[model samples]
Target: MIRDMAKGLNFPEEATAFLGECFDKITALEDGNDQLALAMDAFFASKDYASILNRLAEQTGIHRYSVDMVFLLLCADSLHDIYYIKELPEELFHNTMMDLKCKLLECKALHGIWGTFVTDWLQGYFHLKRYALGRLQYNTIEFPYEDYKGILKKGDRVLSCHIPSGAPLLIEDVLDSLKQAYAFYPDELRDGVLPITCHSWLLYAPHYEVFPEHSNLRKFYDLFTVIDNEATEGSNLDRIFNVTETDDYSTLAETTTLQKRFKKYLMDGNVMGEGFGILLFDGEKIL
Candidate 1:
């Protein structure tokens, strides 16, 4: 049940166990282990990699503490999804994470402050928002785009709105887009494709959500999904051309076997309405 709470997230069984151990540490702290308690507390509170490292460094006498364990904790906390983690012994895992961290730091030193860290922040925000939806048990629509509707401009900012369907997103087009982002931010992709899972609509912005299944309240549900380090519960829809209540959203009115169910839902006038989609992009205009 715990494993299944996380669907889209992928990680090794040992790493999974390690994550559980982390929670257990939280529990056991009440029994004893002062250093462990303090260190873990700091880690849980850390918002960025630099802060995370600094917190651990501050506690020199942490009993039974290893840099690798902290590294593992940081990675797990930062990415939310541990699927990309290499299943290695504690020493090796720590070594790998440290290498990545040091590289990122070095990139910052050479490329100035905002190079790689900003990218991490963006991807983190993307996943965090998706996790929020998953927490509500919101099932996202992962549909395909075969025709030219419109393409989303790509960058690092949390999308404020869903992009409208204009040009059809072909398979090649999707791959090319992913490739470009990967090329632009190669270091972040070292673990694999940095995930970008958002709701059909931009939930990060202060908007309204119609939860007919649960309530009639129109409240903001656009919480960043990455905030939940455990990712034990959340929803995320990441695909080439994800559908939303966006621009010309009614253009999806053409009922077909591919997305008949989704189309019917959109047509139902329930959770999603038409033309509420907004695509987010930064940097390159061609993205």
Candidate 2:
């Protein structure tokens, strides 16, 4: 079942094999050690499962990433349960589950492992707090900006949009996702307005200096009414370069135009950071 789940999530063959091995080791360990068995149960049931799993990893001499993989696979076994309960579309389930694969790849790229530290974030999917409709992932969040206190107010319910790494964020695909979201969460809309919010490095205003006006990313940035921009040192480097270490810019590869431009921007002592924005979706278009 674990292996099937791995394949179904489109995990690479090497990653799938690693997950199978971890699952077998976990099964054997739990079967032989009653205390370990109890801890495994607690991991599944407890909200502080990451800490528990970290302790288990130390006790059993298994890599932390491997422990996380076993836990994720165990969670994957019941993926359909949430879908059934939420009455979410099957396509959304598949699209959302693909995030698992993306994060696994990210882990391998960043740490050379098939495990993830973002399990807490992944919990949103299993706990029914997040969903992927098309090109974007949407989750309910409190309006976090102070600029819109009168119009929207802090703590007011809003749809937080996230861009999952994969295909290009074509305008058509993004529009389709927004259209789907406006329809899917009718109860959340007020006066046919779906308040969507985003805070990401992609929204960093200085990208305008790096990205051409016609670039998909630029187009994405244009979709929002940016409210704030603040310097967050090194936030964009890892995502853009796929390398964890960011202190030394000379070692980074300049394989793409954006990378070359952004790398030069950094080498020139300029910092890149995230921006906060809101998109008012009026059921049909971004208003």
Candidate 3:
């Protein structure tokens, strides 16, 4: 069953198993008394991710940030409880490569289905062709590392819609809806970032955006692919993208498409987020 799901992702089998192992180990908490101590250790160590990336670059002949992004994505996928492919803003996934590693230390499983969440709005707004090479804006949070877990919660929704909402939302309405949708997330959908909004109408709402902190990682690196590429011939691609629904079923239909496509992709392909990387080379290296 696992193999079937990993196929669509087109990832190496060894990598998938490695991630599964990491997920299992973290969740198998025999002791809960050391949560604070464990968190302390992780917090300090996280600051060195950049150094770790440099070391890996020296060892593997890859750029520092490129290797870091891959490491982050791998760590994120390894610890998540679900996976899905969708468009998302570049800002939200800013530290996604680093944030995923942080998430694993705490052992939280991410969740989301395949394609039941795609729309025209998601497509145009969250394209890799535009944001992959952009600079990511940074912010100071209350608990940078501890609160990192919440990043994926935002990521799941962003990827599903292909839109980045630039600013973070403390909207009470969306959080409420997320509570219900998440409870019903399936058993087979074992791992990656998952999002559930507090707004019921927004669950499959036609037009919504992911809070800036949790957009797709590819966007952060300014990466684009032939698959997500499009010709932007004088269109307002930069304006705040919104999806206006013709009827209630518009979002429901989009969500359904996301589900059907994700199932087939997982069953027949490799794991999501384990695709070809764009930052494989530094600016000086020859392709």
Select the stronger candidate by lDDT from 1 and 2: 2
Which prediction has the highest TM-score against the true structure? Answer: 2
> Which residue runs of candidate 1 sit more than 4 Å off their true CA positions?
1-8, 31-123, 126-287
Q: Tell how far residue 16 is off in model 2, in angstroms.
A: 0.5
> lDDT of each structure?
0.32, 0.80, 0.28
Tell me each candidate's TM-score: 0.22, 0.92, 0.22
- Candidate 1 has a TM-score of 0.22
**lDDT digits (tens) for residues 1-287 of candidate 3:** 22233333443455446544432333343432133234323323443234443444465454433333233333333323222344333233332222222222222211111111112211221222112112221111122112223343212322121212332323332233233223323321214323211111112111112212233322222332211222222222112112222122223222333334433433443223211111111222212
**Model 2: per-residue lDDT, tens digit, 45-145?**
65456666767677667788767776777676676766777786777888888888888888888888888868878888876789888999989988876
Worst 10 residues of 2 by lDDT: 31-40
Model 1 lDDT on a 0 to 1 scale: 0.32
